[model samples]
Structure formats: C-alpha cells, structure tokens
Target: MTGSLQGETVLVVGRGSGIARAIVGAAAAEGAQVVAAGRNREALESAYKGTSVSVKGVDLTDEASIAALADDVGSVHHVVSTASARARGALGELSPEAILLSFHTKVVGPIMLAKHFAPEMPRTGSLVFFSGVAALEPDPGFLGVAATNGSVNVVIRSLAVELAPLRVNAISPGTVDTGAWDGLGEKKGAFLEKLSAANPARRLGTPEDIAQAVVFAMTNTFMTGVSLAVDGGQPLV
Candidate 1:
C-alpha cells in the first residue's frame, strides 16, 4: 500500500505456490521487482507468466546452487526463503535421511544463502526465513519439523547479530490452509476445522496473512533478529 518497495529488487526462494507465491504477489503489489526461484524453474516461469516477476532455479540442499543463484541475482533489497522439507512422523517412523533432509533444506541451506548473498546486499537489505509454530508447540509426529524450526529461531538471532544492520528475521506460521494438509485426504477438512476453533483468532491462517507479516519484516527499519509469529495464536492454545 505504501509502495515503499518501489524500484527495489526482492528475491524469494521457494516453490512457486503457497506462501512463496503470495509473497511474490505482495512484494510486487508494493512495486518491487520480484524474482521467484525454486527447483522447478519451468513451473515458476509458467506461474509468473505475463507478470513482472522473473524466475530462476535453485535447490536448497545444494550450497553451490545457492551460491550460483546469488551470483545470478546480484544485489537485492530483500530476500525471503520459504523452502522447507517436511519430515512429519513420530520418533519410530522418522528416518535419519528424512531428518537430514529437513535440516539441510531449512537450516544449512539458508545459512549458505546468507553466506553468498550478504556481500551483495546493502546495509538496509534484509533476509526473511520461514520458521513454524512447530518449534514452539511441539507435538509427537512433528518432531523433525520442530527441531528444524527451532534451529531457525536460533539462527535468526545469531545471524542478526553477526550480520548487523543487514536485518535477519523469520515468520513462524500456525496451521494454514496451504494444501500442506491435503495429504490428509478426507480428514484434512476436520483437522483444519478443529484447529480453527482452537486458535484464538478462530480461523486458519492464509498465505496472504503470512505475506503481510513478511512485508512488515522486510520494510520495518528497526526490527531484526526476531521471529514473527503469524499463526493466528495457535501456539497459545
């Protein structure tokens, strides 16, 4: 609304849908030059077709890929990483590979991003990452998810201090209707309904809701090294 991002470049790393797409839209609406990058470059190109958005390829698990992306994009005003590998299972069901993938994708990957991109960013530039309510509201089946998110929370603080003036923060989302639960099949609706009623906000979160918070994190000059919770109060109850 403020068009504060006009003429600025924003690079968002994630799949071309869900919260990532919403963020691209939000930033673009604020007059930013948005680049959407993920493993599926063709899909992203198609997704943003006819728009001002550009598309690129990236794999969070690969540090080289991240570095190359940083080179390709050059200087940017802000960067948002929404990529995550979900390892949803109980202790017995969780595998070492799955856990490693989760950490590699969410934790180590972003670190690599900062390593390569920070040099190209202005002092006013910022980085936004995705943490989750799982870190705060630990549950049985989401152990891996929680651990990865918890690491992100700590990383945000460390990076904020280390990167100083280059703002680093995260957005922790509660239960959202992002089709992440569609794998639940018929049970998905009921699952969301239960969470909606339980959440203090009395509704499931939307990509746009999280996007609005991200805009704040990117534009707010003084805020850094913090994880913003945009989960509609799901962790409280």
Candidate 2:
C-alpha cells in the first residue's frame, strides 16, 4: 500500500472510462509508469498526454493491431482493461452479430491481451479486467452486455488459476456515471435510483470509488482469481 508499486509499469486498456482515468491517475501518483491503450487515440492522448503515459490507439479485435500494441507495450508489470463494447439490444431482437460483438470486446479482447502480453508481464505484475453490475444485476434489454461481462469475469477468474505464476482479477462496478451509457440517458437516472434504493449506501458507485479498488488489487499480492464487486452493497438487494 505504501511505495509498494514504485517503478512498476502498468498497461491500462480502455483509458476512456472515468474509472479508468482515475485509476491511471492514481497509478501515476503512486509512481507506476502507465501506458493507456484504446481505440480512441485522440481521446486517450487528449486525456493523458504530456505525462509519462504513452497513449496508443488500438482495436483490440484486430489480432495484428493488438499484437502491435503488445509489442509497443513491451514488458510491463500489470494490464488493466476497462475496454467494453456496446452491442446491447433486446433478447430476440439481438442478432448473433450483436451478441458476438459484445463478447469479442468484453471477453475475447482481454483474452488477446493475455495471449500476447502474459508472457511479458513481470512475475509480480497482475492482470485486471472490468465487469459491469449488468453482469450480475441484469436488465432485459442489456442481455448482450450482461452475458459478455459474466463470461469475461469467469474467464479472468479461471485465468488467474491457469496463469498461476501471474495474477489476474476483475472489478464489477455498479452504475458508475461514465459516458458509456450516454445513449441511454433518459433511462439511466430512473433505473439507477431504483437500483440504488436497495443498497445500504443508497447511492450508485462512482468511478473514483472503483479506481481505488483497482489500485488496491494491483498493490496487493494475496488477491486474485476473483471479480470484486464495487456495487455499494447492491448485491444485498
């Protein structure tokens, strides 16, 4: 917790989330060199430019692109993914294309990072992925997202054991106010209120709230193979 991560390099995927940004900032503050990777090069640079961070724009679905990204990343101690794709639609209305799109981004994409980078991750570094509350607390229209997150969560957990020498973990955040749901603006408030009402905290979790946990997981050596929920007790409901 104290200077435990100095001089470590953390490769952060999906630098777009508020939570991801917070995590990057915290990691940098803690003396870890962070390289932010995502599809939006401009956005990542706009957000994290001029720092020690090196932002790379990449489409994780593309093997060559991800491989190039992994090559550029070189050796690192940690890989944290906040990258998620939106393919949400009603169940029957969801085509195989949409469902697969979500899975490719949320599950398959992170797996690619491990595929290419695990061999390079330092023994002490960890791999952390992100899941949404949707995975556990489902919504009828968000079936694709829920299922993908669930799969990714399990994949990361299982990988933790499989990649024994290397550590892996995931964070499931509840209703963090990120722009991911910008299209669902109207429904966002009403649904979140209803969901938050059931939790003892009586509020939705924030990105910074989740960031601290992510950093905690990176610094702690004992924790792995689990997707910790930062849901403000939403599970109790």
Candidate 3:
C-alpha cells in the first residue's frame, strides 16, 4: 500500500446502493477511515460489514441532516457521493413531486454536500460525484435521469473551478450490473442481458469497476476538474 490516505478519512454519501457500498469497501481497503451516510441502516451495515467503517443515517436532502452529518463525520479528506434517486419521465409528463424527487437527491444533494463539506475538506482533498452514460448521450425514455445527470456533469467542472485547490471530479459509469437493474422490475434480467451484449467488454460493469475509479479520483492528488468515463468502451455507441 502506498499509504496515500493511511490516516485520512473519507466520507461516502449514499452508502445503500451496491456501487456506493463498493466504493466504501475499496476506500477502507486502501487504509483510509470510511464513514458512510445514508437513510438505510441495514444497507450501510452490509456495505461496511467487516470493515472499520462508521455508519450514519443521513437524509441528504434535508439541510439539518446534511449539517449534522458533516459535523458528526468532521474533518473529512475525501467525499464520494453515489446518492441517486430513481425517478424517470419527460419534463411535463412526470408530476411535480416525481420530478422534484430525483432532482433534489441526485442533482441538489451533491451541491448541498459540497457546500457543507467543502469548507471542512482539506485544500488537497478530493470529491467524486457519480454520473451515468445517460449524461453523455441522452435518451428519450430516461429524460429525468438524463437531464439531472447531464446537469451535474457540468456542475462538476464548474465547481472544480470554483472550489479550486481542492479537487472535484465526476465519474460516469457504464451499465453496471448493480441493483440498479432491480429498479427496472419485470425487465431486469432481459435489460441486463441486452446491455451486456452491447458492451465492448461483452459484460456489464460491476460495482468494483466503478469503485476503483472512484478511489482513483479521490486519492489522485494532481487531478481535478475533469470527468473520468469508466464505461468500459460502452459509450462508443
């Protein structure tokens, strides 16, 4: 181990999902203290099952909760957010509540996190945000996800400049066979199968694939203000 972050602490937001869980796992493996925040206690435990990870249930959308989480974690060296809320539909097609649902968590959540935590992050600390291929290439069926993902992509670069000295980067992952498929319900298996067939790697990405990239973005001192695509050549389409 390079001990890059041997004594440093990284706070991972949205620890419930498999990708987020894997990120926490990887960060812990690399010698950094891991702190996970999310509303799901069981999922957070599962993520840090055997690691020395501190878990907290934080509602990222709530101001009080966000502030409290930052205070509890205190003096974080890195922040990785995998907090994506599942909501989809065209702009006018979805109800106001439904549209706000995904936007608040996925789009606004990271912004708020940065606002609250950036002040606490060291000058060289890093922040990695998750985006999807949908952000790079838009599709009609996923209007909401695509819109928010794309917006956040731009936000990463813009904020990287504004945040300065500290790093801000986005990780756009390809079809990862994480629980994200279960969200598709009835078509879960078929959707993953089709996605696997489309990938140049002949397989969909795993949580580990994206997690490694997340760790790189977080620990790589000289990198900042860029979005790294960890899609395994899928975006070639």
- Highest-scoring model, lDDT: 1
**TM-score for each of the candidates:** 0.98, 0.93, 0.92
Error of 1 at 54 (Å): 0.8
- The alpha-carbon lDDT assigned to residue 118 of candidate 2 equals 93
Please report, in order, the local distance difference test score of every candidate based on alpha carbons. 0.93, 0.84, 0.83
Error of 3 at 92 (Å): 7.0
The worst-scoring run of ten residues by lDDT in candidate 1 lies at 175-184
Q: Give the poorly placed runs of model 3, Cα more than 4 Å off.
A: 46-50, 90-93
Clashes per candidate, residues 3 or more apart or on different chains: 0, 0, 0
Best-first order by TM-score? 1, 2, 3
Model 2: residues with Cα > 4 Å off, grouped in runs: none
Better of 1 and 3 by lDDT: 1
Badly placed stretches (over 4 Å) of model 1 are: none
Please tell me which model should have the higher TM-score, number 1 or number 3: 1
Better of 1 and 2 by lDDT: 1
lDDT of 2 at 111: 91
Tell me the tens digit of each residue's lDDT in model 2 across 118-192: 998887889999887788877788888888888978898789987887899999887776776677779977776
